[model samples]
Target: MLATPIYIICSPCPQVGKTLIARLVCEFLLLKNGTAASFDVSLKEPSLLDYLPHITETADVIDTYGKMQLMDPLIFHDRVAKVIDLGFHAFDEFFKMCEEIGFMKETVRRYVTPIILFVAGSDRSSWRSYEMLQRQIPPGALVIIHNEFALRGGLPEAMVGEHVIRIPALPAFLKFYVDRLSFSFTGYLRDEKDWSTELHQWIRRNYTMIRDLELRVMGRQSYKPTAPCGRPRWHER
Candidate 1:
């Protein structure tokens, strides 16, 4: 049997579209593969059960730190794909817990793949966060995803490696809509047309990159993440 793929989607800061992208990826995988599932490790806000009603009924609701004790080893046995959405605030604590329980080391040793999706807009602070995260993530385990917000200042290509995937700036109008109705079904329908087009294009461009990373990790290919460059002296204004 093929081992399940677990995707950990996180960022160095909050509101970087971590959950949004995770949901979209989960939906895409569900459509393609029947056994895929997604879960949220956020200790606050609406729980995963609140959003994904399909699996909430039977799926176990383990706390962020409780997963180590609650989850069965066989849970990783199936062809199922799990996406863990970790809120920024709980990220460090969760990592520590993973270490305490030995899950962290096991995850790195096993087929579990870690991919950091960094989101930054025109805000210089966002870029700073991206750079900080780039430096912190373990080598060969990070993939940068730039979320362009159509702002005046764009990030330079040199800052990122070849594995970086650039998502075109989402229109301001679309962002407004997304912010207004992100968690509602109406949001899904209202934005479906535009989002589908944009998302499809984005996925097409980055699919190979994502797939390659997955293959590389799954096949146990030797890989090393590049060390981040020194911090930018000046923040973009």
Candidate 2:
């Protein structure tokens, strides 16, 4: 029995708060489950390392030479919960690497436990990128988190497709804190306050939706079917 790994893939559109949302979600899950871990595949930036030290210790850096390697699947089985941060600028290269290594589909299916959190925003470009990603990702394997201004109209159900989960705009105060911290630490300004109290309230209101999305992606079983007569069925028939 092993716990599934959660993959947070930040879509193209810049400044969409993908990394921040990923960090907050990881923090929330860690606090709730007490056994979760977070990882960052951005070797160049290593943004999540400062926040979550435990998972960083085991992270594998992907550099320009195109070297991408992941930890053994068995190691992550049931021992830990993982949140992966995919950098915006590195999306194409990272995806190419995943394809080259055959890790995208193979690893996902082998682990039998994985989630793809695609973060998006309200702007036209961001929403467009979301639409594109939705089509590219595997069915029942995508979770959409919409990040918008607190007073904005929020997300539309039709835009993100059926399996989407909208995380409303972040509170003003939390957004300020995140912006300041991101600037001070990484020289990168990322505003992701939608994970604040106000946003959490929204998430709570829609908790069932989130749970259902998780179930669809990570709740898959590794068991195989046997003969109809209740007898052992061999693959080599």
Candidate 3:
């Protein structure tokens, strides 16, 4: 059995599809026979809360109770895979609390596989946040996710040496339907849907990628590295 993962899908920039990636992870975990849930930290209505209402809840990291509500379960509950849809506003406080409380140590101690997926963005702030997280979190616990749908160009060879995952961009036409229609991937995939369409193919490919990732992390699979897509790593001027 694949070990359950705890993913914190985060980015310093808004609208870079952090929730989009989180939703996918949650769905994939459920399909793999692992229970999945999420903590929605976005101030407004994030897509995770909007769609996966049954699997997620609104969370805040500004106080002790909220931190307990968020961190304690992740550390103690080994049965459910959890996703934290971290937003821009709560970035600093969340990591601050984590670092101070030895969050990574506790997760490691409890045998929880913690994966911090920083959604890739182009802005300088995004890169800085990426670098900051690399420093704060335990080394090798960070997995940078390149959201090609909203970013441009390829990554800098120096930013992430290895273990980067890329999400291919959704075609504009498909994006239109997704934005206009209220659909759930888990529901749609289990029900009737064309398996040959671009959207379906895209979803399947992502699921494959995630499965490959899960196996790779647990030493059950291996694959050659592909050049990641997204903005190049930012260098200070």
Candidate 4:
């Protein structure tokens, strides 16, 4: 059987669409299965939690108490799939604590898989960050995300991880629609008014990508997560 998935969306840079990816993944899992929990570590702007208020909680890991609030629930609340929209500011601290406490190992031991989606930028630092991240993490635990909005130049060759995911550029005309406070793809799908619209089509495409990526996270095709110290070669479709 596949292990429970804990999706952690993060990046070394800010405004790289990490929250958007997290929201889409959480929504996709909810549709495929039943329930999932999410964390918003955005100290500056917890917009993801605001968008998905129903399933998300705000977590600040700058202090010990804040760390406990986030880490405790993620470890003990094994009842549903977990997702963390990790902020760029808290990136170092979050991963550092995880490493010191063996967060990934402990989760895997409890039958939970840790999936990190590291969003990339066009700068040299992004590539360096990606390489550093790959070294610190197990192979199957990381996926490189290429967000076209920021990195129109595409990801550096060195930034490629075991698996690569692309978040296509959102159409300029539809940007305002999605940025609205009430705009949610999951909520829109539940309403009958969007059946024949372009927004619906865009969401469907996102869903397809999320599902395929999810298969890999769940140990399918080229991506297979094994026991401790063993990580399969995760690849993109």
What RMSD, rounded to one decimal, does every model reach? 10.3, 8.5, 9.3, 6.4
**lDDT agreement with native, every candidate:** 0.52, 0.54, 0.74, 0.76
Regarding TM-score, does 1 or 3 come out ahead? 3
lDDT, residue 226, model 2: 29
Cα RMSD for predicted model 2 = 8.5
Candidate 2 lDDT, 164-224, residue by residue in tens: 5555565677567555433321112123345554544454444445456655666664534
Q: Rank the candidates by TM-score, best first.
A: 4, 3, 2, 1
Candidate topping lDDT:
4
How would you order the candidates by lDDT, starting with the best?
A: 4, 3, 2, 1
Question: Each candidate's TM vs. the true structure?
Answer: 0.61, 0.65, 0.84, 0.84
Model 3, range 68-137, lDDT digits (tens) per residue? Answer: 7777667753568888999888988888887777776555445567788888777788788887887877
lDDT of 1: 0.52
Q: What is the TM-score (0 to 1) of candidate 3? A: 0.84
> Which candidate would rank higher by lDDT, 2 or 4?
4
List ranges where model 3 is wrong by over 4 Å.
1-4, 156-160, 220-237
TM-score, prediction 1: 0.61
Would you list the clashing residue pairs of candidate 3?
156-233
Residue-level lDDT for 235 in candidate 1:
16
How far off is residue 103 in model 4, in Å? 1.6
lDDT of 4: 0.76
State residue 234's C-alpha deviation in candidate 4, in Å: 29
